[model samples]
Target chain A: MNHKDKQIQSAVQRALGDKGLSRRDFLRLSGGGALLAGAATSGLLYPGTARAVSTNARIVIVGAGAAGLSCATRLNRELEGAQITLIDRREDHYYQPGLTLVATGVWNTAKTLDSNRRYVPSGVNWIHDMVAEYDPDNNRVITDDGRTVEYDYLMVTTGLQVNYDQVEGMSEELIGQRGVGCVYDKPELAERTWRAVDEFVDNGGVGLFTRPRGDIKCAGAPLKVTMLTESRMKERGTRDKAEMHYLPPGASLFSQPDADDFLSKNFPERGIQIHWDHPLTAIDPDAKTATFDTPLGDETLDYDFIHVVPPMSAPDSLRESELAAQEAPFKGWLEVDRHTLQHNRYANVFGAGDINGVPIGKTAASVKSQVPVAVENMIQAIQGRENSASYDGYTSCPLITELGKAILVEFDYDLKMKPSFPVISPYEEHWVPWVMKDRLLLAAYRAMLRGRI
Target chain B: MAFSFVGILAVVLEFFRGWFWLLIPLIVLDLVLLGLFFKRTSGRRRKFSLPFKASIGFGVFTFVMALITLPGITRSSWEMLAGAVDYLSLIGASVGFGVLFAILAFPVMLHMLGIGPKHKPESQATRQSPAPETETGAEAEPSTASQQPQG
Candidate 1:
């Protein structure tokens, strides 16, 4: 190995504490790097051979996000002679859940953004293109560049598309104005949001945070921003100077009962006014005002700062496909049986994470529970055995009520409370949960996403 | 006969004890109450609109089948379902209780608060479309050029 490689290995060994590059880890890193380099250089691994010896059955995965990468990792481990290809439009993969912390100045933007190629498991092919058409009948998907790839199995994890156009008189251009920002969009924009918040504080203006209607990736993120922003202002001694408003489309602070009580009671003390059942309808950037459709009536509020959480929906590729038209409520967010995490139509196909149409809250914690279930079911199906493994619909929401206190709400399939650690009660906000949120969750998230867990 | 068989098995499991007598009447009362609830509620119609209706139907079907085929299955199934109901009711009671406490504790009436104004939709027709390209190879920028300030 080269000197630089030696240094990296040494550092990794030190970091991992005597694990000393397991055979699995070495193969994964080297194979993944070689495949990426090969793809970039020659478009194919071997010049003369049509297919590599390592790849037998072709597996296609849509989206290079958390779910797609996790699925690819599991498939690589389970199916040894399998050709896996992951396709995504973007060059960078983002840790989307961290955007909440980024908006509140708790995390830097660079921490959340990483190269998409860094996470793809070894022996998997990377196709950097948006899917143009999904023809499930023939078991093939066409790319925007007119390249058609046939696959024995297809896993769709495109998650959600941000619909910024839904708000009247609001365009993408309106962002980063006077004090306008959104944590739900691009992770890179989060730093700019912090700057906007800082400016809002300096200018003695009202900070308005909004939550739009429909299914967002992390439902608690908007409130996270609200609480963190309030805490930041208190630290800055600007709490009394600037007003804060949290406008949400939902009737309550949180979908979980325990979380809702904590937020409703504690938020008022922080001088945060919550406009429940109020959804952002329009934004007058020039006038520095935002209009919302409240349950009572329509209201336009003047604000120095505006942070919008855009309405999200299933990815267009999945929505337009024939698989989506099958018996389901929404489009084909992968028609996986909730328990088995296996596609109802095609047994080979499986899904995990936010893309699944389960009623559970879409969070990183939800993906942690889903990965094991998907892997178990996928392995069983591959071995021609009965797939008895089931997902419990487990999800967690760490509601950061303040800088030092958080209410960790965990629940299962039936919305039954499932706390990870025994606390006084699941509803009570405590400092230990907050510490877990700030310190341990990142390590857990990285490990879980890498499928080490 | 299936119900009697399951009931008899329950009686057997209870050691043919007098406690089994109480269970029989309770089971009958539960079945009667469930039937009454279904009959009185508008949700009994087969033309259900919600997505959860199918799952509910499947759960009920499984319960009925288990009760008919095996007494043990019926007892276990009933216990599990009852446990789920108990948990759900506890959460519901907590929320309901909290709401009641909030209402009673707060002096200000909820109805007294003034309603906020409504949001009006803008006219889309008058909104300017993208500008046409110029001959000088310069793209004409929009009239309202609001550049985002760099951090």
Candidate 2:
């Protein structure tokens, strides 16, 4: 046997223990090589060094989120000799989507946070700094620490910035006080919302949840918080004492009609009050009064506890960039072709995740879909080939409608219902969707982000 | 019933050959289902006829394109599964196709059902009428105030 074969056999032997390998077992272990050869023969595997040949091209990826990491890893593998540098301010990469689950005491923040180094590929350089200025004209970006890096190719995955300031007389510090908790604001604060919810239940107080207008990451998250709180309150025998209210800026419970129908019908039965078209405007921590803009005019409601989902917008660096101005249609967001994910003006620039102006819910699952198209087009562009790869804007939202039941809304750019598995209604909360969200999605995110598919 | 039977046949074919031709029957079934959904939900003549047709057409076209390109896509995907590839091409393709279908399908589905932005009564009225010039004058103060931040 060859050296590589010997190594594989030894590894297999260790895994198999004292049991002698049957012919079937041996073939199964080495079947990967046979499949690869079959694929290569069929001209499926693109020929060339698995890495990019452009050694002189310096690629800079902004933000170390799922999209940024996925892009860098792909470029590092495909663009053989190209130098890649990933910039982000945070030392730890938190799976931001898990924050909603964390708010419900389902996941711990520590478990969601991973060392940024784990996601960064070996050959690529990692810069632990945020971008202060993006000058696409000069083909360079300046870091907050005053370091300027020039690049041949740039990929923006800075994601969205949470603006708690948008709410009148509200700041980050005021969160988790006087029953005012926001699960969407900071990853650290997600746990505090749960604490506030628990405290409110103990004190026999009403729990109020509010969703702000505009594009928010994981659009279903606010509802997830409300449902989980209700479920928890029922378990604690406080369902009668604590009235759960969901005040949303939108006219419906969910963007998807089927989901809205399911939630609207089911929640009322569970004694959860949903006030549609009510946007939270102000909060008084001292008096515990929450003010909302209703169609009936401004109404102030008393609440002992509140969970606020703050308004979100595109990152400031991207909003000010030339790419945003050039692509007028997507005004404040990164302007890339909806299909190929290539910048309309700059062929060398690309985007993925929340940074893109695509009219899809900003979630990690959305990033999961965009990452590959962005990588494919970038590789195609580098190799002087036609950028045939396109993105259809697939975004999945794992709406935890209750403690152990979730509704997985998987859709594309057109908002067509696409379930991962055959669902009875697809929009209704079920144990199957919940199990996948709670158990499978995290591993999938980690695997996909690392370019392991 | 015929569409469902064809969909089942397509599924059987897909199981044997792994070609996505199965989606053709499935998509046709979905269109029939959509037709039934509209007929039941709207209880009126279809108002979003163009968008509804476009959604079904787009779904079928995307599925066909996806299936034809499956071999090339699956090759890289299989490599990733075997720990030999790291590009996530297969996952990306699935997601990309899924997203495309969703974006096209949502509006049609919503409009047919008489919910969402398309069916909102006020929005329709606004589309029909040109506001008086005095309305622009009234809105000018807020626009100027918003512009000051940018300047």
Candidate 3:
């Protein structure tokens, strides 16, 4: 054989061998090869080696969540000799996307647990403290421990917090007990939720799933948990024994029109009742009753199992800060331009992730799309130039419909479907999207954290 | 149900369009490698097993493609056998891609081996001619052998 033919023959024989390489070694080799190719072509994996702009400005990022870590990695790579300080007391990084999966008993809690230290790039100042005050006028922030740090540029990415107090008598400790479950934040909480779901599915009962008022992270999460719980009961042949109800705070079930239509029709077909314009007000854990504030009056209902999704808002520090918007609609959130992602009043301040007061896009997919734009705009401002990047509000959600099927719903500010894979239709339930949610998204999320697309 | 070749072709095209940038270069390289392979096996065609070699090449290529795209399957055995639907879908997708790849690659492989498209006989004399039948049969033997299920 010729040289090229020999190489081809040898490679095929070696790959098909039974004992040449272990599974882990094979994965590392192949995954590394793909990442190397991506790095060479897109400069996303190893962006620091590419052309970096020189700057000495002190950049401070306020969170170590998905958006904050992504910003830190991108900024550290694109800017040289810049003092980047990441301020967040969180050492454990939770893969928030997988929380729903864990809550439904599909994934182990360990799969969603990771460390922030793995993604936080070296050469950046890591502060193990939370910001207590945001003083934009003085261009400085005071931490909870009374340490004042001044920055020439500020990137606010403090993700939203869930307020369990809004639902009276409901608390985190009540999860996994008394037929109460909530699939939000913290892998432990998700695991606890799974225990409740497991019990409810085996011994069928009246299950109440709720959605709160205003914007929330992963708006589809509550819906996913409800559907997955129903699916699990169906899988166990206990579906007929259970009565389910979905309570949305508003008339609409989803923000996107097509999805709302599909879900509005889908829920009833599956025998899961829908109660619109019902915002959850209180939950009496001892009495096993819940109250909803409706248009007519207060309505209370007894439940064998209840999912308590609380109203979410910006962190207390940022919401009460001077940098927050002081008007209607987007009040009490970080004041930022929808496109540029820069602070409206403070030129040096920028916001990303859930803290930004944009019309939509509060998911991890939005963080992936927003980090590059925000980093590019910050670099341009550092060079004393106009902002060159604009965020189009791209966000995606793999809406799991059943145990093994999902609809990959992707959209932008216009609420128009923008599917990444043409073969997978955005409107239909398919296994391809379920596979993406179950097996692919977590890796993609990690890549985003590393600023590797 | 009657099979629609055009529909399957469209499905394959839609599925692969995302990887066109990589597919184009790999296709060009395949043509080059086939050229070299054809030259090396021209005189020894009867001695070498073309079906075995082609199957090996295609199987390895499809497997590498799967590994590159779906890394989670190799993370652990739990990922592969987690749920019956998930396990079956992963295997089904890999096999489906292989079938589509074979459909796309067979024509190139045949052409590289000097087996062009079949032509209709011009007349009854030509149709009954032993010379034409022998020539066509000789060229088609390897193609038919390669198309057989290897597993």
Candidate 4:
């Protein structure tokens, strides 16, 4: 190594030494790292049918986020002689899971920031534009730039949209000021959110953490930000100075039965008053007031800080398209079969990632699981065969209870706890899950981009 | 992004205060592991063990990750460090921080202990070897028909 490299390496070693890790701990993690690496490379940890099916079909994918990138990468690998195109206007990719850490001040925004160029595969044609309209009947999409792209098959993975404007008197600009924070959207927003959260935790006042009902990405993030802020208050010796409240849009805080029960009990112990069925309707940032549409009536609460989680749905173009579900329950969401992820009416069209109107799993872990099923099924479609692969609504949310502790809540369609690590309990907070979030989860997310797991 | 000593303490305290039922066992296990580290490292032949090497690698990795994550928190923003939850937080965050600290620092400590990868001279030869031939890269043999007298 060069002198500069050696110096950098030396500085890192010194920093690690300062942190107080001993030789034994290194040995343990070495063993753990080996297992992780082995599991990843062995094709057993997250295995799927990974062979190329030769075809001359043109496949078009919408969006370039986690779901889009993952789907495109896997499709590139699994299909030979196929023209695959990924369409999205975004150039930089943000690791959305790390946004919670960014907002909570556990990690910097860089942990959540990356370039799409790194994840987009070699053979796939990347179109740096967005779809203006979806012509599903004709198997073509018109772009905002006025390009008409025809495809034999289509995959929509556009993710979700956070409607801050839905909340009256609130905009993206209001964050990081007036004790307002929302841990969604861009990395910059999460960073701005930390500023508001920091001021609230330090000064000590009424802090309101709210979550919207319906489907949202990483359902655990709002909870994590609240607990982390509370923990920060406890650490700051300002716990007594602040009154905390959690507004769940529904009767329950989480989807999983066990997790909901745990939170219902845990909140009371933490001195947090739960306001069930109170979904945030509007916010007056100037008055530091929030309006919630509760079961009783429209209640307006004054707050020093409010974590605003906006209701999310498919983008307007897709929601307005014929591709969207036309009925109740999953209205305005991508219309796909819950198990197959294939469009109910259109067999050649598939949905991957958050766009699919599934029961649960709007998180990135769902992307990892859903991508394989979608890709395999897409390949089967290309070969004029039956789509045998099915998705069981697998979703993982590493629900952080505190800064360094989290509950790795992995579940399937039945809401049954599926713990990847058998010893780690899904019901209770554990250090391993926290470490996984902070230290390990991103690597897995990236590997999924390469279709390795 | 400093991953402040205080921020780490908050996590420990939160664990104990939030999940108190699961600390003593973890603490005892960490304590035992620390003892083993000392017991193993005190010997003369301590260089280049997996434990030693992994400690260094993990430490380096953590440092790199922290370098990226630390920008999230500034030194001035550590005012929250003043608060403590219960009596358990005092022991929990402290002990927890201690154990986690040891785990993170062990790799660096191992490196500092002069336990680096010892390279054998033969490994240098491996780098100089020619690229392995792929089926396409292999030269085509002369056709028997072409080698026969021209028609």
lDDT of 4 at A350: 97
Candidate 3's error at A79, in angstroms?
0.6
Which consecutive 10 residues in model 1 chain B have the weakest lDDT in total?
Answer: B107-116
- CA-lDDT, candidates in order: 0.67, 0.71, 0.82, 0.78
Query: Global lDDT for candidate 3?
Result: 0.82
DockQ of each: 0.01, 0.01, 0.04, 0.02
| TM-score for each of the candidates | 0.64, 0.67, 0.74, 0.70
Error of 2 at A199 (Å): 0.9
Full candidate order by lDDT, most accurate first: 3, 4, 2, 1
| Interface C-alpha RMSD after superposing true interface residues, each candidate, one decimal | 23.1, 16.1, 12.0, 14.0
Model 2 regions lying over 4 Å from their true place: A1-49, A52-55, A325-329, A423-425, B1-151
Tell me the lDDT of model 2 at A134.
88
Which candidate number would show the highest DockQ if scored against the true structure?
Answer: 3
The residue-by-residue lDDT of candidate 2 on A339-449, one tens digit each, is 888888888899998888877758888787788889888877877889988788777787776666666777777768776555224755455456557655666677556
lDDT of 1 at A380: 68
lDDT of 2 by residue, B25-65 (tens): 56676677666656554523343545555666676677667
Residue A200 in model 3: lDDT:
94
Q: Quality of candidate 2's docking, in CAPRI categories?
A: incorrect
TM-score of candidate 2 versus the correct structure, residues matched by position: 0.67
By DockQ, rank the candidates, best first. 3, 4, 2, 1
Worst 10 residues of 1 chain A by lDDT: A44-53
Query: Between the candidate structures 2 and 3, which one is better when assessed by TM-score?
Result: 3
lDDT of 3 by residue, A205-309 (tens): 899999889888999999999999999997889999899999999998888899999999999999999999989999988888999999989999999899889
Evaluated against the true structure, the overall lDDT of model 2 is 0.71
